[model samples]
Target: MKAVLIIVLIIFTSLSSGKKFRWCTLSDLEQRKCAELSKTLTAVLPVTSIDSFARISCIRAHNTYDCIDKIRVNKADAASLDAGDVYSAVKLYGLTVVAKEIYEQGNCVFAVAVAKRGTLDIQRLRGVRSCHNGARWTSGWNIPLGFLLARNDLSWDEAQPLSQVISEYFNASCIPGVGVAAPQLCALCQGQKSYVRDKNHFCETSSNEPFYDSDGAFRCLKDGVADVAFLDHLAIMEATESEQQEYELLCPDGTTAELSKYNTCNLGKGPGRGIITRHNFQKITNKFLTMIQRLFGRKGKERARFELFNSSSFGGKNLLFRDATQHLQLLEEQLEIAYVLGLDYVALLKGLGHEGSSLDNRVVRWCCISNAELRKCEEWALSVKSDPLVCVQGTSMVNCIEMIKSSEADAVSLDATHVYIAGKCGLVPVAAECYGQVCAPADEITEEMRNLHLKHKGLSPVYAIALAKKNAKQINIHNLRGRRSCHSHLYSPGGWLLLSRYTVGALENVTENCDVGSAYQNYFWKGCMPGADGNLCKVCIGDSEVEGARVSSRCAASHNEHYYGNMGALRCLVGNPSGRSFGDVAFLEHSNLLWNIENLKSSGWAKGYTAVDFELLCPDGTRAAVTEWAGCNLGPIPPSTVMTRPVTVTKIYDFLMKSQEFLGSKLDSEFHLFQSQKYGENDLLFKDATQYLVPATHMSYQEILGEPFFQLAESVFNCTPAAWNHVQQHPPVHITHSTELGSAVLIACNGGFIIFLGSSRVNALD
Candidate 1:
């Protein structure tokens, strides 16, 4: 009887104690609010029968991180954390999100850079005074700074603190909580700094600091203490009408937009605060939160007595949850923290020194074409230590694309034309090469500028020009019929597609069902359109002479042919070493035009020709200096892009961005990433004129190619019966088919064919 009585008493004690859910509180005000919440919940429990409704108890912690630790150790059941802290909590503490704080804008918020209208240029933010909500905060520090780091506007050596990098990037900043780690960043702060030790509140992450949060940061900008303010979109939305009218958002693309357009014109978007609990404790915590929110949420039955989201009575902003939060949304699905925070946002945070889970240890297999590119790839493989790269050689660029699509290779850099074909093959662009002025100025390039260039280089537009010798007076855009031409390669955007759009398409009125290759073959009497057969190869001067003195590599699509890329096309127009000109006009990208001329001159191919000797054939039947390509060109072209499978896009981008940091410098003596002279070739692996590789993970092939250029590509690839017959006869290495109506059919006369039919899509892999 005594043993049974003792066992019953112990059982009752355990049940009652375990039924109490402890809530983590970071400050006194939060603890007070949590106590009130506990009382209100207990008061409402008598009216309901929720089995998981445990009596609430407040557990005090030092800070958010402490709260995370306390909850992880099971001392506390749950706590609300910002997106950044949520990443840390889930990543480091192995906690799980049970519910999210839903604001009026849903579960995510936009981080925006705001400056006085017409007062600042988004691209040139270096050395400017800036305001941030607080150190390590999401919209204030992490998002904005991470954006700069991701774009290459700020360079960081992972060994050093990120605060140091920010201090050097900006002249002064009002970043609360930076403290003494970076005093200079707090130079523009309005926090108290009295001689009395306790009175000093400079850069404190509290109300004591004048510029402590989003509202304070905005005030700093308005007071003219800071040139720009980095804060969440809600703060901007809450600003007075006149204040909104006085400022505009600085978009990451180097453009400015009105305040109302924050959705598209912000640094980046990220998840909102979420309620997290110990990994397996989500079931009970979720039910507990659901019950409390039901009674105190936006439309709670007892909201008039005690509001869950509102913190005014607690004497703090966003105490238990953001005051802006409307309700708590239960997240029932098991989700990876990265999925909740977003991959881009996670990448940004990872770049900003918030280390997360380890990166995949798999090596990236880079696809290479030709012996020269293989050698360069081999050397590059040895250069990068973090992301190991291995070389996989293919017979040609198209073959490389096939290899990548078949999982035999991981990545390859291709011109705009090939990028389109790759996209059709289910590959995506991870990065793009920026040439000339679009990149950071080589002479004045700083780490910050390099980073900025890496971020915005994809937006840089390329131009196509119709190049003809100054002596060819009759070779204007109008009288080019039957003239010998030198094209970069078949299906090349600037050389073939844009040229055909202006010349053949315009003259023949071939809107639909057009055979662009046949049209070019018939239009040009004799020409070297690399990758094409018959008459197109007649004018080609191959790499060298064979035993019978026959041109060995005539009209080949790669650098093995003497007349292949933009430089090679220029070489064709400049004539052979014996001064035997092969063509009257050349079509190619305007990038490095002057450099190509000088290179040829130095190589003795154009012994006495100067840049002035070349002229641009204007579309209006006029001729202008080559430098006037802006006013006299075929059309704007997109830059070259690095292609990879969708699953490997982020992995490839991370590798390339790191590679650029280590090897992109022209000053790097071991192996210059952009120079190919040592390989005895031009544009191997990547374009020789490339200044740097920019991240293109967020872009699609259409976005990278731009709407106009993409449309032009579509028109060029809309094959007619003749073109289809030509493709069948050539019988390329592989054939890809798409079922969707109006899908593009990209054909490479010498390499492969992509046919779109009104049937199921198929990949005819060899």
Candidate 2:
């Protein structure tokens, strides 16, 4: 009975031991760090009723991969890994990233090529002798090779092994990982073959090889045995610290620069290392999160007791984390591993030598402004994540446009006013929203809209009109010098151009200082003209601001701003009280009037207001019904255009065209490509009245607004005629199915309707 009772007692103790959190340790250094960390954690954690603090036990493993396997099978709860190793654990073993390692430089490190000054130029790297850290590693291999493959300078056979292709491309190399696959891979390795000090080593991927780690690769170059050493920026920094005069970094732009400028002159970039754990240990991972932070974080309070990140105890580098890591960041639940590393890096790893998923390579990264728009974009991203769609958030449309120019984002849907700015920044219109019907076949075309191309419906050449109460006849067209007025924006054709020009000419104040824009600011006591000079925005209430400014003019520069665009001007007129920054009349597009008037209750302003309360102020000093805008409206304006960097027009066009085919008007889709429902605003992303999207071949600023109209806009915006002339002469080229690679096939839609279509739609064109 005593023997049986002792057996039961041993089983009970083992079951109780399971309550303790188990952390995987790969090396003696990691085991020692964990031992020190556990003691500190015991003191910090809350004690239980049994007087025992949160307990931690070490789980031993031979390598990081073994530790990941141990976690997967529940032998261990967690382990830290390099990004490349994290990718493997997440992809192959169902591991989850709990935290990311943020180094002093940041979460990302640049991969660069370093050589003796004047030894090699970036352009002719072909057949050059090379030194690489290892095969399939992020910084040393994937980044450098992916950069080469993208430029089409390095060609290889996908059917053959990756090692064979790499060997053939380089005249000689000391790449460390390939000795197992093929000995020729280490043909240039200078390590002693019989070094018995290390077992199963020499020209290997680990520290066993003399030319394996980043330091080893640089040593190859330092000894004058290799022409170029491809390694991470951190490695180069560490290796060349003592001998700075002999080495220089290579830039992708065919030049050599200082090693300190590696971020700007590198092959590519990759994410930092991270701590990975199995999904089942989420609770344990969460528990350890705070404990680990207190013990080893950048500002860890318990770091004095033990250095968790030290990687130099053994003759090798990299313990639980890279030695260079500054701290570990707790990752949010929604942040995916691939997303943290960036999709491009993951895609390269998916298929090193062969053509991987085209969808991966052709992801369309979009930029949006405002949290509301970002929410909508996130929804859109979910639908097209298979297309590898990604979204970047910006503060304003101007910021989005800048993102595209810097290659930080792929595209953004822009307003006509923004299109002009984007064009000046070297962007081209790919497709446009079509508002009017395509027009029945030639036989069915009507005489009133004979020209199908002129069927703008409610888009460009759109009439701009002044709306005011009928009783406001006291404000005649010619005698409104001191009247308060509302305008769409400072630079919009409808708000600033037509009305300002007419009012200035009427008042005979059209000189340089008293230009149309300034004259209106002086004439109107106070108006809600967005983007207008200072006091003009006194009546404005928008919160968003330009980069250096304190506050955004009350007019909306983006969806985030209130009363910013044509609709904003209408809101300014109807929402604000008259004479207190509100206006007796509003200068805006005719469509904004029609759209908002029908949905006033939805607009949250002018409740109980009706069309009978407003009338059009014609230039001829006569009042007319709002419906009579055709007769009373100002000069026509061009339709809104979708613009992108000239280099990416073709790719963006192809993706958009494909998207529309499945989610286009013909398909029954869950999401509307050109719709939003925030505050009952129908035209958030694209215009609500859109009919289709069309190509905009040979479209120019001058074409959108005829030369005379363009000149007027230039004057309003204070643009030089020479510069304006240049914008007109070189019309933006649109990429099309038939257009050659070097040329453009500009596509346009009417009324700013964002059409969801693709190359399939191109064939649908008559």
Candidate 3:
């Protein structure tokens, strides 16, 4: 059944989780401005193990899930008291030691408590009845765990479960501490045992009704049953006002002293709070610096920035300003140029020579269509000309030319920037926008790299299979001979080459014996290496290969805007907040996660790929003086917009319902366009746009192309009409209109992007 559960009570800010108490420490009590600044502000409840207090306020505040905002829960600290809180701090777990210390010192203390009625030390009752909430209490759990173990000389497993202990106390043992209720029991411990008759002492409904309790141990002390009550500093402060009037101080070793029941307390520190936003923290770092200056003067501001330094301010999302290596990469490729008003007016191009040379390899294509690490060779070399144009901003012509001329590639490609740079270099401005795109470091195949692909014409699968069979027969002969197989293992490369040939000759076709299988994924990390123990077992290749996925890209967090965004961008889906009962806590982590999934994901139909904006970095720290687009594929993300969470089988069902139409549409469109044209009609194909689809209904190539399409096809370019040579070739990204190739949709069986134009039934999506 479909379900929508509204469980927002688990989320909220730490401060307003409950009514103010008095047993809190002096510093803590001061921050609890419930008296002087008593403004009832509504906030989303943060996810908490015990969020009853915050839940009450949230239900009363907005009352509806849609209107709720600003979550209030304990700050996420990896060292905090709960596993749930630690998990929520996902990325925040990397904060430095000092930051962790500060966070601990604040609200979410790392300490727990030991309580008996209200008195902490229950030494008098060696075997008394003890009962209270389980270890769910941060303070109640931690303090007591440590304190009780030391005093009783016992470990956790050595201790009995509460129910069992209570049972034994009544029947077998004589322990004094018993029952988990606070106020009713605390009243008895504090000297007011009469309150045990009332149920209100343990309830949150009405304080006047006895069960209308405030703080757990505080009530135990209030009712006069216990001597000492323990709680975290934040909880202690928010619940009370008599700062020092509560409990007496205890030693770090857990020994307690008798004093006022609500006076002094012991506590540990925790990490503190800060602001969160979606923009790249570095780009607006200057603005952040200014904000700090205004808020805390210079030193405090600087310190604040320092505090946030390693906390996502400059991590995985941008150019490596934080990491020295990344900083160096940028320094290596930057080009500084200025555009004059009118002097520079021609396009400057990076002259990567056209295809066919060895040195002409475009190691990194700045024009990444939401992808990087140029796939297999050839295509990798011609990546420079992928994108059409880029305009560089510059100061003066002289400055621009110096920046442009000094670049690693050809002249900076721009209508004006190149004009000035070329002028400075004495190379007069030629034509602008005439040539589609210019490439540099013209490809020149080197002998060595070429040797890697040169076919020595090794044994084909067919020949190998025949020999393998013969070899397996010998292995069977040995087994049938009943001779034991030896297990000793040791071999040098020279020995292995000699031994391998024999082994291959013998076991290659062990398939005849039903024992043939691949070692490792058959490639990549060559099967296990030999060691003293033996030859490491190579991984067996299964039915799968290295998977490829594409998701929203954080590869460019500096720029959140996706270019040419279209319907495909809808692939992004907002996630349902968990742990947080509060509806309004906007976790940029969650939101950004969603944003990236959507921004980078597109159906095959949504060729709306995005690329990163980058300047060239050269080997020498000087600007390669190049600027262009680049892409980084952020592996497969949520298949559907609704899958804001990680991939799940259930989520796939929903994604398909919404995005099925895009399947095979790109190839289908090519087919339909080729089919739809009637002779003599104006051509629908336009060079300006990469995507072409009929408006009303989807059509196939066979269904669309007619006499008009054939006539239209003839007017534009000559179609080499030599019986359509139908052979698969690699991607035609660098497919040149050479005399030998003719006008054909060359497809390569081994290429990354599968092309299915000529095939009658096949379809391509990658």
| Clashing residue pairs found in predicted model 1 | 151-451, 152-451, 152-452, 153-451, 153-452
Which structure is stronger by TM-score: 1 or 3? 1
Evaluated at residue 679, the lDDT of candidate 1 is 72
Model 3 TM-score (2 dp)? 0.21
> Which lDDT value does model 3 have at 36?
17
- Per-residue lDDT of candidate 2, residues 252-369 (tens digit): 7789988787767887556666778777666457545655665556566556655666656544566556777776667666455544554334444654622233334466888876
TM-score of 2: 0.48
- Candidate 3, residues 458-521: lDDT per residue as tens digits? 1111000000111122332112122111110112111111122223221233222111111111
In candidate 2, stretches whose alpha carbon ends up further than 4 angstroms from where it belongs are: 1-67, 133-137, 154-169, 172-205, 209-213, 223-225, 239-242, 296-305, 313-316, 342-766
RMSD of 2: 16.4
Instruction: Evaluate residue 618 in candidate 1 and report its C-alpha lDDT on the 0 to 100 scale.
Output: 87
Evaluated against the true structure, the overall lDDT of model 1 is: 0.71
lDDT of 1 by residue, 499-546 (tens): 876667732565333666767777888888888888888888877632
Worst 10 residues of 3 by lDDT: 459-468
As for lDDT, the candidate ahead, 2 or 3, is: 2
Ranked candidates, highest TM-score first? 1, 2, 3
